[model samples]
Target: MAAPALGAQEAAAAAHMLSLPAEAFGNDPNVEMVWAVKAYQHAQVYFNLISSVDPKFLKLTKADDQIYSDFRKRFSDLKIDVLDSEDMKSGPAKEKWRPFCLQFDGVVEDFNYGTLLRLDCSRGYTEENTVFATRIQFFAIEIARNREGYNSVVYDSAKEANLGTEVVSSG
Candidate 1:
């Protein structure tokens, strides 16, 4: 395959980064720059992993139900609760859920709060979003989400934005 044009690659990277909140980093410029780089690295890792499986998958369709089913099974095998309805409704169950959920600690410091929060704020964390899931779960949900139609809108918008700036050379 031919290499992506430099402008196209930069545009794509810029588009991917638009998900981050600028104001969140307003308190510290150095920290903000660090997080931006970390977030970009994390996103690159994810995109590479997903693309390796099937480059056209995201543009085509969502994975089958079995893919998501297997995701749940993996979570169970890892002893992480799926946080089912009954689990959510009970105080004890909710309390038990903390350990299973992803936490920012020693193991996660490489990614750190700046990067993790970027992913969480945009794609994970909420009930409706996939980021609330642990790393494996997050990957699973995002793979499925991209395959489905959900992620197409962002790219479409990105394309439009890129077009508007194609005339100017940032370099």
Candidate 2:
């Protein structure tokens, strides 16, 4: 059977992220950029595993792209667009930094045994002042029967040992 449409729970999660206090994420240099990269990588790995076992879990659409685009737009709004990989690495600036979008193409089965699209973001990195930091960001949305959807909880290197319940919600 065809996969179900995106559901309220998924929407709520997305909205919750949008409503988060930006200050919660500090720009401390010790934050270890690797955390972001690891989170995205783990999310992608989970997507791959789920898609291989069941092809009815996640589904991607034009709207999915729009969601990503909107998130990217926030960088511009924050006046940090210059920090964006796309704008920072060009022409003479190519030697300094570069940004990349994560890409994934896959399918998975949902709890109800329906097919869904798996949208993923891969690893991206930038080099500045001879220092390189990797930033990876991605999301997996599983669409089940009855038009319900939920996202996979992403874990980072920091949470690896503890296997804690904290979910990485952003790139």
Candidate 3:
């Protein structure tokens, strides 16, 4: 069967994600940047095929055998690794910080794949003194066929907000 068409919202979301600045997501180390690109490419392919079949099934059972095979090969080539997530804390004089480092060592099946990383930090002190909470998210996707490609980064982030709502974000 042929795939269904993308609605207006879906189209717009895809466009937005491609527009976000690489720095806005805090990928300064370079390797992580590459992972982002790879993930985006993988996602694009699945997005295009949404009309064809459910992506969840595609990822697990190889519902889209060709796409699955291609993904496996490409993913194997890109040897992605989390290099570091160092906690930076100083005594009275030093500022506190946490930095995450990652490395991408592999070839992307196509220029379409990319990734997104998000880091959030919150601070709180107990009555006696010291405790803080930090949360980090490293989201990556392999965009296969993004009509707008990287230009849709901003839209993609916005669309992601709709997750669990009316719109759903694809891997």
Candidate 4:
């Protein structure tokens, strides 16, 4: 009975494994690491838009789609704090995000794969500001952040002056 219980516990833990398997990053020579290129391009486009446009006017979803409002309704119960390392890496948060993100698997391109999300919405996608998240996790959090007015700092005059410079200087 104890052996069975331990197996069950392990199975449960495995369900929430958030880290992408190393092999899944593409070991095959023919694949040629397209996922990496796609992820990098995705980050560039995201940062380019945020660095220049006011978040309020930024439209991530189609006009009819309600991803932003839907994220608010579904995850309202979760206490979203500073969106620090814990929210991106902790088991509890990953478990919660997994199902929510998986729901968009067929809808959003590369919904389950790792992508870059900026730690602070106002900042550029620099090594210090970036974090890894599933594509939908990035969308869900950013859509909500943009909608709730938390991302207004991107448009601040001082930041705007440095925005182009930051992206060019960033590695």
Candidate 5:
């Protein structure tokens, strides 16, 4: 029947769309880390671009304010160091950075939940760091701060390595 044929064709298209790219192998240890770093970098660029227009658009709203509040509460509820919005504000440079942990629980039924991860935001003068959060949470907190004109203090550690590179003098 025509309906059966159409359904079969649709299934094939869906599978193709879900297929992974050619280079996604689980052999290397750094692959996941590299992917995460790239994702975070892209998110920063996108967040800056959008925040430049409507600053307050990402702030906690009545309908969904609890989401952000709940996320932060988890830190305190767990007796971990609680870094509120005030802590997120930029501050004077310091000799060392304080590290904090974030707890995340994804929405999907089969997805991992209750994962705690640590992040050091020493480069960024702000005390709060969302590096361990999901992309949505990262954007939410970062955008809210960006809206308030609190610039991100996160500095790239890679720059320090680059700084150590030496050039040979010509004879």
Candidate 6:
């Protein structure tokens, strides 16, 4: 965003922006800047929704073959970490996630593309917690978090914040 850009909104005027600056994305060739930006933005939106809105009322996909329930059942059998660390995604650990990632083929957009993911469920994304991973890796972990009640802290904290706001207003 710091780069000079056209004020014009026209496609012809903005044709130069079809690809973003490489420096902004650390020049990861496998991950296009556009895809990474959109993926990150969507991830932020998803976190916001799960934090502000109850997960039970959420709908992720448009009437897939019970993907949510299916994911939970399938993921339950894995003996690996619950998508909490970068160790499980590299070298030998990849075996656990590679097949897992394959299961979500056609289920998630750009499942194999690189993405940023958080290490802890109790906290939002931060430099310390963020990890470079496949899009499927991010979803596989987060979806598991949502179903297993690990993301409850986000919702619970939101409720407490709202209550504090109400108390201040009443006072």
> By TM-score, who's the top model here?
6
Q: Which ten contiguous residues of candidate 3 have the minimum total lDDT? A: 117-126
Runs of candidate 3 exceeding 4 Å displacement? 1-28, 54-171
Q: Which one wins by TM-score: 2 or 5? A: 5
Whole-model Cα lDDT of every candidate shown, in order: 0.41, 0.32, 0.31, 0.66, 0.36, 0.63
Compared with the true structure, the alpha-carbon lDDT of candidate 1 equals: 0.41
Alpha-carbon TM-score of each model against the true structure: 0.34, 0.22, 0.21, 0.65, 0.33, 0.67
- For every candidate in turn, the CA RMSD to the true structure comes to 12.7, 17.4, 16.6, 13.0, 15.2, 5.5
Root mean square deviation (Cα) for candidate 3: 16.6
- Runs off by more than 4 Å, candidate 1: 1-40, 44-66, 69-132, 167-171
Q: Which structure among the candidates has the greatest lDDT? A: 4
lDDT of 1 by residue, 1-171 (tens): 122233667656555554567675567665545445545566555544443443225432133344445545544433221223433225874465444333323433221232221132123223332222234334344544555444444455555666667856563
lDDT of 2 by residue, 88-134 (tens): 33563343222222232222111111121222211122123112222
Among all windows of ten consecutive residues in candidate 1, which has the lowest summed lDDT?
A: 109-118
* Superposition error at 65 for model 5 (Å): 2.6
Better of 2 and 4 by TM-score: 4
> Which candidate model has the greater TM-score, 4 or 5?
4
Model 4 TM-score, all chains together: 0.65
Q: Candidate 3, residues 58-115: lDDT per residue as tens digits?
A: 3322223443344335443332222122221234211221111112222212222322
In candidate 3 the C-alpha lDDT for residue 151 amounts to 20
| lDDT string, candidate 5, 1-171, tens digits | 011222566556534533555366545454444444444444445444443444345443332354444544533332122334333333521111122222223432212211112233222222244434434344334433444344332222333333455332321
Candidate rank order under TM-score: 6, 4, 1, 5, 2, 3
**Residue 55 displacement in candidate 4 (angstroms):** 1.5
In model 2, which regions exceed 4 Å deviation?
A: 1-25, 57-141, 144-171
Q: Candidate 4 lDDT, tens digit per residue, 1-171? A: 001222555444433332445575456542333344456667877766766788777878552146666677778854432468677689987787777777786677667777877787666667788788887878888877777777777666546578767988994
